[model samples]
Target: MVKEIERAGLPVVHICTVVPISLTVGANRIVPAIAIPYPLGNPELPREEEKALRRRLVEKALRALETPVDGQHVFED
Candidate 1:
């Protein structure tokens, strides 16, 4: 799906918590998030904390849209 989306000439940014797994599966571009169970939000965490984490990761993913690269890339903080 990632490749197909990119092949269609659209900018693709894959947000994943388990970054290595996504990369192993051939993700063209990936942004590291929190964790696998909760890529954007962790249920055990307080709502505010989860929201903050999600917001931060989301911002990074969005910035990735403006980043141009020639191949698979990983964004980390």
Candidate 2:
């Protein structure tokens, strides 16, 4: 779907736990996530901490969307 969106002339940032899968799917902008079950949050952590983590991930994704890429790129912390 990421490729399809990009093909439509829209940029997409794919947030997933597996970087390889995102690459295989031709995601130009990729953001590494925490886990499969909880990609943006850690339930074991305190509520505030989890929220912070999710916020950071979202921030990174937004940054990825802003940045230009000639090809596949991974936005890592």
Candidate 3:
């Protein structure tokens, strides 16, 4: 579905915590975070940790858009 959407000329952004999954799925525009389950935060961690994780993830996402790729690509942290 993602590739289909992109192929239609509408850009797609995949915000992923798990880099491997996004790579296997062939995501051209990708953002990577800390983990697979939460993508941004871990409830077991301190509040500061969670906040910092979220901020970093979002920043990576913004950067993913600026990157240009010839084909499917995966952005990493």
- Residue 73 C-alpha lDDT in model 2: 94
Task: Tell me the whole-model lDDT of each prediction, alpha carbons only.
Answer: 0.83, 0.96, 0.77
Q: What is the lDDT of residue 7 in candidate 3?
A: 83
lDDT of 1 at 45: 83
In model 2, the runs with Cα more than 4 Å from the true position are: none
TM-score of each model, paired residue for residue: 0.84, 0.97, 0.73
Give per-residue CA lDDT, model 1, range 1-77, as digits (tens): 77678889888899977777778877777998767777788898899988988899888888888888878899877
The positional error of residue 71 in candidate 3, measured at the CA in angstroms, is: 1.6
lDDT of 1: 0.83
Cα RMSD for candidates in order: 1.5, 0.6, 2.0
Model 2 residue 32 CA deviation in Å: 0.4
The model with the greatest TM-score is: 2
**How many clashing residue pairs appear in each of the predictions shown?**
0, 0, 0
Alpha-carbon error at 76 in model 2, in Å? 0.6
Q: Model 2, residue 36: displacement in angstroms? A: 0.5
